[model samples]
Target: MRSWGKSVDTMSSSSRSSQKENVSASRFGPKLCGYCNEFLSNLDLNFDQLNICGWVHSMDYHDIHKSARSGCQLCIVLRHDNTDPEDEHWHKAALGAYYKGRASIMMFLKSTSTTCYSAMYGQLSETISYPGTSRRQRVLDELDSIGAYHDLNYTPPKSTESQTAWELCDAWIKNCIKNHSRCKILHSASWYPTRLLYIGHFPTGYLDRDLSSFNVQLHLTQDKPPKGGYMTLSHSWGFIAFEMLKLTSETYEYRIKNGFSYIELPKTFQDAVRLSRFLRSDYIWIDSLCIIQGSEDDWIHESKAMVDVYRHSKCNIAATAAQGPTEGCFYPRDPTIVSPLEISLRLGGEEENPIPKKYLIVSDHSWHRSIEEAPLNKRAWVFQERILAPRQIHCAKDQLFWECNQTTACETFPFIFESHIEYSKGAAPLALNITSLDLTLSEMRKLRFCETRHDPFPGNFISYPQESSYSTYSNISRFDRTLAHLEGATIDEKIERLRRNIFLDWNNIISRYSSLELTYKTDRLVAIFGVASRVQEALKDMDIYVAGLWRSQLPWMLLWQIRISDTPPSYDCGPSWSWASFNRDVYFYAIPQPHDRVLINVDEAHDGHTVAKQGAASSHRISYLKLRCLLYKIEPDIAANSGKQSRTRFTTPTNPRLGFRPKSLHTDCTETDDYWHQAYIILVIGQHEENRLWGLLVRLCEEEPDCYRRTGMCWIDTEAEPNITEHVRGATDKDKA
Candidate 1:
């Protein structure tokens, strides 16, 4: 059955072709050889030779312009002579070839009919056909009828510009490679060859999974921990492929086998140098020296490796004692420390040294001042500023032999002497316990100061006077006030002096709190003082005055609230009747009441007390009334309670229940002619506060009615007498019945 259907379709197609050929003959007259511009002249000529020759000519001279009107006549005649009627099989084959060519032409000429004839003649046969043509012409005519002819050779000019997808891809790849090559890479030991390159602000975690696919590791460092900063890798180009993969995963390991440890710096000068040398060793990495600080790109790249540097290092040697025991002790290193003998000899001879060497003599009393007052070389006695004082001996030792003249009790020489004195008070010491002249001076000062300032009172109290040592103490004593009174002090000097005293006091308080070690209490005190100082500074110009009250007493008020709340301090009690009362008196009276306009619209629905008690009320219920009050510059206090003693309330209703409700006997007011005549209803509703209803009522009153009247009552003069007898008779009859 399929074969039969195919045979029938073939027959129908052949019949349609025959009909199209007859139509072409009627329309174009005859077929002409495209190569010669002449009629075929013989239907029996060989078609294969002619078609092949035409195709070859079209391929060779397709773009060439000829001076003659059409192709060579001899070429067309030779093509016709090659055709023969005896070769019926060849003619049939030629027909099949033409049908195949027509199919291609139809496909190319689908958009325009003119292109079909042009393409067919230009390629197949270079001859002009008559208006009504042959078999080839019939095919062209049929294609034109179907609007399936278009010039395949026609192309639009290259005026429009657009990038192909592949071009964009190539450009992106090139940029990525360039970026990767220029960037630095950091590697992890665990990941080995898997490296990460620092890409600007690209997240490390995002690159982790991405780089992992390409066998690369992404490392990131956080200022605190867990996340932040940039990504790092081992090779510059590794990030390109890593980014291309678009990996997003955890880049850090939260749990590890080892715990955190601290690196301790050596105490001795020789040992400190040795430690510094060890840090500079090939295997060791010191960020300051190893990372290139001047290069922004280098810093950006190395910043991501900070986590690895700290985490993988033997230990981090935190230099807490870098700042010594004096103001500006953090001065840059120039005059280096040497042996104590060298420094002492350099100050002329020990005996010839004229400059007063000030030693800070800290004792239980005012020993420093007593030592200063001693009849020793006045020039040799100097007092060092004690801010950032060293807590350990090494730092003091480091400064002792330096060119600077400052000295402290913790230095090696001073330490040995003090230790000997301490032991001598209790037990016998070795020959090494012999104290130096300087040591003797320090001890004598300690003794004299103790005698005067450390006179134990009945309660073991000692009164230290201002004439004592110049050691800057935390306590604001008569000594500090006296110092402030000194003449010729500049603004910087005053500020510095004030800062010194304030810092001392602050440090002392911190020390006291530390001894107690109550974290919450310490934090509270710190926060209170810090916040108070901030507030004072911020409100320097404002008239607001903040009393220096103890935070412990007033637990309800926070420093932030005091600075930010709109209402004044008195109303700060948390939502109580007293707070409401305070708010009413203070805030309500802060702005003066307006009295020019007489008429008032009462939005009873939104009245605070009413809304709080009754849940249904719309926000816009009082809107119109509010507008009227605002127009007149009236002080429209919404929800005003009628009675004198009623509490001023402010509460919002829940969302579920809202809008107006029906009027009842419970409603506060009834229609009255006297007041109604003078007053206006800004709005009217079933409920008193409905602005829409009241607005309509007000409009009607303004336009239509000359005077207001009650629905069922008449206004009578106040002095009129009542008909008492008639009212009494009516009451009596009702009682008898």
Candidate 2:
């Protein structure tokens, strides 16, 4: 076969036709073409529908787009998976030969075909699809049938820039409280933020001045929880300064004597207070307003309590679309844009058959467009808040969205919005229960042993009292009872199952947390510390959170690969051995089979000598990791790096035929991107099933003679691989090249 781009770079239109041939291949039955259809059905090529699939890795992004635009079905599917369905040109791109219909079309086919059920993995997980053949016309006709049911159906109201929208938002919160009786609240009353801004006044700013505005302040003199529910505001403090309005040493006493004037606050703050008071909440917690902005001691204590502050609240009011304070929470929008496309189709899967079935094909990117990709959701701090909070009301550009621990829905498709987070290869589907995020590492290892699963098929999306998935995840003690009530026959099995589940949840958390951007590099671990502390408490020391990883999942945890294009942190976040050491997206790919051989031992973690800086999480900094592991010297391929090194290449000292080459290699960026001559591999784990050796690439730490700095990771597979742990243990210093 010719190289992939050979045809694209040179071949003319007429010559490119290799006869529109059809053949039965790869179990998806008859195929349309040799490339796309064939590859889609190949099990070996399947990598759990992750971001970097075999399809994405095999073809260049530009090349794939070219093929997709030129009418390649396979390329179309690949491009579709990578992009937001909201792209108008995407519809055009999917049109003609490349078009596979919108996500709703896929939803109809998958829901009807052999391919769905994760609709709603507690409403978000894999969106499986049938690998079989079907024409576009047939898919469209089927969707129309569902559209015909519109008259009898109760779709979510189309959003509007009206006061009614605010009422609907309130209804969503009320529904959660009334319906989800078992949902969790992570913060203990003792850990509540020391202060909360009163939201008694209207958003527009109010003062019944004659009645004494000074009485507005409720200065707490005792350790008593407030009587009324308090909501938390999640927003971006824009660059525009509002120093006079914020709480500080100078303003604290003044604010205590006199509550805030809503009119003087930023637009975002004004809207947040408005929503809070409207919801009957007595107080609202905003970081800058509630926490003393300039006081180091106060900021440290308050910052550490972030997780509890947000999780403790009745709800989080997110100004998702607001890039800055001036861009208030309420965004004006056209109601028609978010409304579903109602249509009627034939009863059966025939083209133009005359029996009617009504349907409402909603925007495919409903929740995603409104919330996930929202500007505020991208903040590093929001990562923890999003997961920890029991429920949230997101104020977005297109519409209002509701996200609880179990479901994510928007005004556009107010049912379970069918969307998927690009799950990493080894991470577990996000936990259905907020308190269930595990602090263990075994999930990463055990995932390879368990059967790969797809959730059971679900029935039609109907209008009603929505599906209830509430769980009573009150605390770690509650989890113990939950464990006792589990399906496993043996207590040990139940515990193990819980362990693995939480571990999987941890994987998802870390992978996602790493992808976010932080204003302060030091806040990397600080921002997520509450999650760590809670999970640690829940696990009751099932696994220790050392730096950015768990103690139990070491070797395997260390195997996590930095996402391609993930840049290095400008300052030290943690040890080179930990993913927290860098500021970038990272993921673990479960390619090699299971393993039990651990070739390294981590010593007692050393603490950083420096004082925990302001805005840093207390008691969670590790200076460096001291590991006692077998090391092997490897020589660089000089020919590969004759110029400035883009990526350092390595090979074993042995002959080419017998040498080891890593399956994947990622080099860290530095002040000077140069090759390290004194390169070595720290043997971490040995896997027998895949005959692979997983290790870390390190170089002698120039600053410290005996220490080593992790430069990258290595996964080597050789046909004649030996017992890695045994081989490394028997070798000596002479093995160095």
Candidate 3:
């Protein structure tokens, strides 16, 4: 075999020379063609005609409007003068077939190494369709049959103006408390925290302030929990006003125990207290007030109960408009934009006998849109608050939005809002729950395929339009949607599937959570621990619970990829081997179903000092893992690099993972340090797919000899297959798996 580190220039030159000599002259159609009295000549070709023709130099073809550059493969072979890559213009009469379409655009972008091209393609592909009809037209036509088209076109009246959000919040809360029992403060469910603040009462027109002293109480264990439900405030801590009363261990024991008052509190907390009293809720849970600041024990204890605190509350008051607590909950918006448009339709033809119709077009904003554009909605901590809370009243800039487990409503079109039940259940069809009869495999495949195509990305956690769309207007209710998703022959089988899917969803949630920014890096595991706890409860029957991965399907969970173009932190947050190690975006692709993948035996896990242990979970902390598996030394590919030394790739010494090729291990930035070269790869698991063994790649830590981190995720089929023969290397004396 040739050496691995060959120069790329020598290889390309030799290959090109051989290709030119073998070209057949007869294929050029007499070598010349006349177009507009200009002679165009055909040249020797290599690769394929489609590949050559599809080569585009610039992606922004419209901005660079000109003939195809000579750098394009097709330009060297076939002479074309006028064809616009962006337009229907063709080069030579014979090669005039190229046209602008999504497929061609994808082809041109696919050859690029830049991830930005892929991101751009993803955006452009969303609008691509067959010529003649715009994507927007398709959407409008789809809505036409449902009578939603009128609502779609309805505009606000010229004279109408927006209303104050405070009035709207009052109206929504009073109506829900009176009519919706589900939203009413529960009398029996009484849960009290260690300390509570009595936000001074508010009167009809405005809130009365008693700045001299603040009412604070330290609830006694003997005291009965509040008879009525409490309200929770979910807002960003924009700035802490020290001038306000501060709580500490000393104050909790001495000053606050008797009766303390303070003049200062953030605007958000003040607004929340006002809303709480207006809604008739007695108690409120404000973290800054309830928990002693800088007390680790209290923080940890309270943080663990985050899910319960939000879930049991009567309602969470989300300051969606506020960037910080100081800004308050209310946001200013244009009066004209917030008001609905009026439309008049003519029923009869001709002005003499025309029948005029008037319709009110309510500019109803989807709940998804309201949450997506909100500033507070972007905070990571608030996400869990929104998800776990049984109900939330979003104080958005334009209007107040009501959301609970049952439904979502906004001020402009409260009754017309979508049901949250179906949305929360995900994309399963409603039919599976209605009928006890088994669905044929063919039927199940049809339903599952629909879920696969939605392409739920990390961003979906933030935008949620796909899930909302599936649950609201789709045929299934949220309750039934769960049944549809977990369809199986028996209840036990269905439960198994549900457990597996729940874990999958956890992976999805973590993928998004990892990408989000946090004020404290240490809070990484703590921020998502509640979600992990919830998933653990769902998979309780399963024996294995490793750090972030489950023992039952650890192999599949290990197949996570840190998204390309995302910059990982220089300092590790957790173990490098775990996705939590990098404070960047990570994603997991579902493993192909029913594959023959065997977990490496623990006995086989160790070589020298390396130790392998089954994964274990700790309370409110990161999981630790160690596995001793196959190790491979990386080397430069000389044969592949003959033509360009700069473009040379690193490959394994011996053929590893036969059918599965290694993905590019490099980060998006070209200036990244050569850490991978010094890094060693460990095979975590082996999969038998299509008669070949595919192994997952893990990067070994030089500092911590036994530990390793996940590198580029999958070793898949690649366009340029480098020589990656495995190199046999002996393990260190103490290198235990």
Candidate 4:
């Protein structure tokens, strides 16, 4: 028989079972009975609604000799007499063997007798109607002929203990490397790091090799830096000595002279080095090993280069499965769990000839769950690492996951969803349409499309710009289109726009990052400094980038509110005016205000002590900030004050007190302490509530004399019995607004 195959692109998304209809009709029309041959000759196949299997298209109904039981490939294969249809073991084993080339499903079907195919066909008709079976069958029938379907009989050569993940990952990476348009990397020296560690050799099995064997530093000569790409390791240290493998004064020279032996490093690091070498890369950059851990100066310099290290690396090896440094990346995986199930159909009871077994690699959705909920994803540092890396291969516990700028894929669902495209249900005219757009915007719009937001404060809430139900959809769609439109324009300009937009959307990023775990609260700014630095580089103008706050975007930013927490942080790490001062959870919800209300007046000038002014250029490692702003002294309402809680109320020489909450009070005032008499507040922004007013509250930063930090947020509904007219009159500074 002549071989038959076609490119995957030729087939429709739902063309799995239907492809065979065309192929079989063209090849076997002469062998079928007259009626079957006539039906096959003029068959108008509906690509939209194909049969579950090709039997409907390949069978001869008139002649018993060429009946579906004997003539159809699918019917003949689905009736196995040697194995039980319900036995998963044989099913999985057969599927594994076929994938391993030890067995062939196509060959088996041709060789099997279809005399008893009717009984198996009936059983399949019953079970295949089940939703799970139907879904799996669709996925399997969809696989291209060239794809690997795992089998039980496959084994590695003696030189290799088992299959290495690197070979698979290398193949994937090499394929991606060829797509020049999508594979370009920024090689600018500023962010593109030069120095790296060269792990000893390649093609070496990691099973029993001594870690010490891979120890060599590849110091790139200034004239000739290695042309090929390098790999980076992003894993959690898990209470291990992160400061141990550093370039300190005492160890710097010795370490430079004597390269870092993999055996001395943690298991996670060792695995990373091995994987990098296997990926055909000459260099690997492990954070703890590359950076000077104990040296402050070296850390200050190298820490700023974090963006370059991750963004420029060819691939980031994430030890997603490992909880700590001690846990290695690779773990034993059961073939049964990894392999898809192969099911066979049985026909004609106990009296007839046996049929061939049909093979399928079942789709497992659990892989997505494992990847998303991986322990590594929970870390604050790893969050940035995962998002920044251009391409990353997650060494997960259940299965390996691949993520890039384009899409996220796992072994089970190889092509679940494209990153930049949208997919829909069913066949045309409602079929899937793939369009390029910002994935983030596309997702956010989906949420908005289905969500219904009700007016929370209907009575006397601010007269803010009321958003229609479809407003979010329109806004996000416009943003998405704008991004897509800038693709071929000046790259630098596009990057600058992306950077600025990222900063504009900083609220969402900060809200999530602040709640994550961090060993040192002071490192909050340093940890995200890489992200900030990248954004800064894209900016056409120089603006003050304070600890974790941007001076250019203080109005909306200053309204950040704290979420509930056990222990509120102190304000020593950063100025009280920034969220960086608070280590607890925070979020940004729009504070209702009039459409025309001006939040702050940047052009207006007041005395140095009274006007809002930015401090000097923020040093990457600095803690303090200097800002001058209008401050108002206020007294707390003792009855409404909640000790240490984010909720409270304060009165400004006015009858209607302003209700608010602060992450934490900084006056060293106990519940019984009369700090309310000395405490001061600033109105971040005022809202028009039924023509009345309300505002976001900020506590005075005493250290800076005039600057203030966000404590809590509030809305004053003056139309209610407890009026806020006096508070508004006292707090509103029209000139400042």
Q: Name the candidate that leads on lDDT.
A: 2
Q: Tens-digit lDDT track for model 2 on 1-737?
A: 22211112233323323311222232332223434443332312221221221111122234445555555543444444343433332322211111122222222111111222111110111121101112234223322332332221333344433545665566666656654433433324434578877656444323222322322342442455667678888887666655435778888888877867656677787777767766777777877777888888887777767767876788999899888888888775544445443333332223434443333433344455456677887788887887767688888876787776434556654433323321112222233333345212222233324444422111111111111111222222223344455644444444455554554456656877788878878777777787776666655535677766666666667777775444654335777776777778887643223334566766655535122543444655446666666676787767656778655555556443333546557666542345457778877766555566788888887777887778878776634344443465465535532
Model 2, CA-based lDDT? 0.53
What's model 3's TM-score? 0.59
Cα lDDT tens digits, model 1, 173-240, are 22222322211111123311112222222221121112212211122323222222221111111113
Tell me the spans in candidate 4 whose CA falls farther than 4 Å from its real position.
Answer: 1-164, 180-194, 200-214, 218-224, 242-248, 335-372, 415-501, 565-568, 591-596, 602-651, 654-675, 679-681, 686-694, 700-709, 717-737
Sliding window of 10 residues with minimal summed lDDT for model 1: 337-346
For model 1, what is the alpha-carbon lDDT of residue 114? 18
TM-score of each: 0.15, 0.67, 0.59, 0.59
Ranking by lDDT: 2, 4, 3, 1
lDDT tens digits by residue: candidate 3, 152-220? 322222221122344444555444555544334322355666555554345554543444555545444
Clashes of each: 39, 14, 44, 16
Q: After superposition, how far is residue 455 of candidate 1 from its true place, in Å?
A: 29
- Model 3, position 665, has a per-residue lDDT of 41
| Alpha carbon deviation, residue 33, candidate 4 (Å) | 41
Report every candidate's CA lDDT.
0.21, 0.53, 0.44, 0.46
Best by TM-score: 2
